[model samples]
Target: MGSIDSYIFRTTLTSFAVVMASLTGVIWITQALRGIDLMTSQGQTILTFLGLTGLAVPVLILVIAPIALMIAVAHTLNRLATDSEIIVMNAAGLSPLRLFRPFVYATLVVSAIVILIGAYIAPDGLRRIARWDSEITADVLANVLQPGRFAQLEQNLTIRVRERQPGGLLVGVFIDDRRDPNDRVSIIADHGTVLKNSEGSFLVLEDGHLERFQAGQQEPALVAFSRYAFDMSKFSRARDVAYGIREHYLWELMWPDPNDPLLKQLPTQFRSEMHDRLLAPIYPFFFAAVTFAFLGLARTTRQSRNFSMIGAVLCAFVVRLAGFALSVIANQTPYVAGLQYLLLVIAIAVSVWLIRRNVVIEPPARLVDALNALTASLSRLVRRPMPA
Candidate 1:
């Protein structure tokens, strides 16, 4: 690679990395806040929240990488054109295809990253997060260990222990089960024990009265019992969740088990998910094609390429949105998979043709004129005096 190639490649790669991380961090924080209730209501620690949220980063990276590469390519090309560096190279007999080689190299690198995250990192992260959430929810000690405070174990269940003895006995146990909309239960016992079995944990309440209230009426029906086994599963249901298509590993998706009931139920959905992951690496280069297709052969004048940049952004947006739609449609109709690949191939072909021809996108003067007229009318409306 020449000095110019090295310079453009390095600058674009750095810009892509920075943009990707910034966008991922911002989106991750927005997503992580949804899990804050785990700590605020469910008595989870700050570290636990961070751990669960951190596991989602690989998924975020998968979504952010291609857009970042496109932005980086467009930004670097615009800067070069504005500084007349591209013109200098053009005068020295550098072809548009030659100028785009560095960006293609960068795209190759970014594509590898996308593939790695889509195939391995994201699925593994999701699996770990599922396990973490299950363990936290099923932990009887964390949910009900406090001696004098009522802990809201989840959305509908609450428990309070007056005292916890040294030998794993709970005294003055109070449990409120409001999970059922039709029947709300309140159980108070002299003492209780927490026991775990193959199915789940159970809170064995001794010498307690069960108060059950119907949905509409407030009056309660009380029944006394020597021993009552209140299934702890009702309080928290963080058991082994049936793994969905999104949660399956790449290999699992590619070679689905026909014996598996979930796979048998929705084969196309699983196949769509697999293809989505497999196609992750291709779109980055396709985006690079669309990006450079707009601004590849730099203009000799000092005129702004704002319109060209907007055109490139719109093109990229349309292609990506179409891909996303195909991903959804492919779940039901697998033939959308062919349409997705076709769309990408068309974009790539047009991009290469434009680069070879050195085509320059011009501003849409009619749209610009319309926008200007609208703004002028708005300005006049704002400045006009009020009627007496």
Candidate 2:
């Protein structure tokens, strides 16, 4: 590639990386917050919590990459136009299509990344997350049987142990169960141990006394036992992992097993997801074309490029929103999926035509004048001095 092409490509790619990271990090933090209970209540280590939450980053990148590419393309085009580089290139016999080549390369790179994540990495991450969650929830002894801390295993149920012995034995165990509205059961045990077998999980308590208090009666019934088995199966989750449509690999989606229970149940969802992943890579190119069509023109500073930038952003937003809407509709009407391809085809065709013809897109005269008037009003309001 020529120096100019390399320069444009580098700048655009750098911008894309920066924007993609910023957006993904911010959104990932918000998503991670929702699962903070992994560390806060589930007794998971910080690294484990972060690793589990970090598995979601690939999916976020799959969604954010296209938007970041669009923004990067817009930034590069606006910079070229602002410095009259586009005009200079035009004067030097560089056609609009030639000037657009660098952006196309950058878009291709981003699209490949999106495709990789969407087709395999993202779904793999989701599946691993499901597996991790199952393992974490099913290991109830590790998560709930802490010494000296009352662990809220579930709503209205609490377990606490004064000490834990070397061999997985719990000492001075206390259980409070108020799940039933009429009866509140409390058990104090001298020692306990968790047992998991083919039947289910159970907390076997030795030398325990059980006290039952009914809502209506002031007196409480008590029972003493040498050995009591408290049902802990409810607190333990099933180890079986069930994956959603989004968790399927691309090949699995493409050539799904007919007997797969989830596919058999939500066949429409499978179809929609397959289409979405297939079309994921094309969006970056579409976004780049749309952005360049609006912001690639060489106009004087007096022309005000703000409206052009806004138009580009709004057009990109509308196109993406339409794609999302169509994807949703495709779940119900299978044929509707074709409309997304048609939409992108038409948009990219129009954008390419406009770029080739050097067509400039501008707002209507009336809208411009109204915006100018509103800006003046706002300026006056800001400049107006406060009364003493």
Candidate 3:
């Protein structure tokens, strides 16, 4: 690459990084918000919450990396035109193909990153999330206690704690049990701790008083205790956890176990996931190609290029949407995977033709003049005011 191509390449790569990071962060926050309950109600620490939510970032990047590249391409090209840099290059005898070389390099780099993220990084994250969720669900001690909040296990059982200390002492513990309609029991303690043993987990209340209320007796019976223990096994018992096909490894998706019950069953969905990942890396290049095709040439026109930009955006949108549709169809028929590659080839071909022509895309001259006249008439009508 020459000096100009090198400069453009650096600029495009930087823009892509910035855009991809910004997009990933924005989307990740929205997705991660769903896990906020882990910290608020599930007794999970901040670190645990972050770790669980952070697992989704790689997948988010896989989905948005291509879109970021296209935006970066459009932005770099537009900035070049706005600063007349492209015009200067053209005057220096730089052909359209030569000028577009930088974007091609940047797109390839981004595509490689997409391949890594889609094939390995993202699936690994999904697997981690599955394992983490399973652990949290099985850790009964952490699952049942929420500091400074009243947790209602059911309509009759209510538990509240004023706060919890670092050493595992729960302060101001209150438990109201009304499961037996005839006899109600309420327990209040100055402190409590959760203990796990060979048998099961137990919530042990210390320095507490237990009160019993018998219905229709109109009098409450109260007794004090040094220590009281309640079984917590129901809250923390481990159960079977199921993972989605997305959590599976690439090889698992490719050569799924025949005896594995799921692979033997809904094979179509597994095939669809595999094809989508394999084809993701091919999209950034074509998306960049389509965007560059519209504004590949540097024209001296003072008119707005908004229409041309919109046209390019719509064209790319249509192509990508078609690819998504094909992926969906492939779930039913694996043979349709070929159509995705065919679409990419056709898009690249047409884009190459557009770049070769090196002409500015716009509406007909007559249409532009007519639109200008119409705008003038509308301006006059608004300025004239109602008849006096």
What stretches of model 1 exceed 4 Å from their correct place? 140-238, 364-388
Instruction: In candidate 2, list every pair of residues with a backbone clash.
Output: none
**lDDT per residue, candidate 1, 1-388, as tens digits?**
8999999999999999889988998999999999897676556778988999999999988888999998899889888987899989989999999999999999999999888788788988898888887888667665555779888877988889998775558899988989888999998999988788888778888998989999888689999999998777655556886667777888988888889888889988889999899888999988898889888786857555777788888998988999999999999998889888888888999999999899877767798789779999999999999999
Output the number of the lDDT-best candidate: 2
lDDT of candidates 1 onward, in order? 0.86, 0.90, 0.86
- RMSD to truth, every model: 7.5, 5.9, 4.2
Clashing residue pairs found in predicted model 3: none
- Quote the positional error of residue 134 for candidate 1 in Å: 1.4
Model 3 worst lDDT window (10 residues): 140-149
Candidate 3 overall Cα lDDT vs. reference? 0.86
Writing each residue's lDDT as its tens digit, candidate 2 over 1-388 gives: 9999999999999999999999999999999999898766556778888999999999999889989998998888878887889889989999888889999999889988988999999999999999988888788777766678898988899999998776678899999999998999999999998898988889999998999999989999999999999999877865789899999999999999989999888999899999999999999989899889888866666787888888888998999999999999999999999999999999999999999999989889999899889999999999999999
What ranking emerges by TM-score with the best candidate at the front? 3, 2, 1
The numbered model that scores best in TM-score is 3
RMSD, candidate 3, Å: 4.2
Q: How many backbone clashes does candidate 1 have?
A: 0
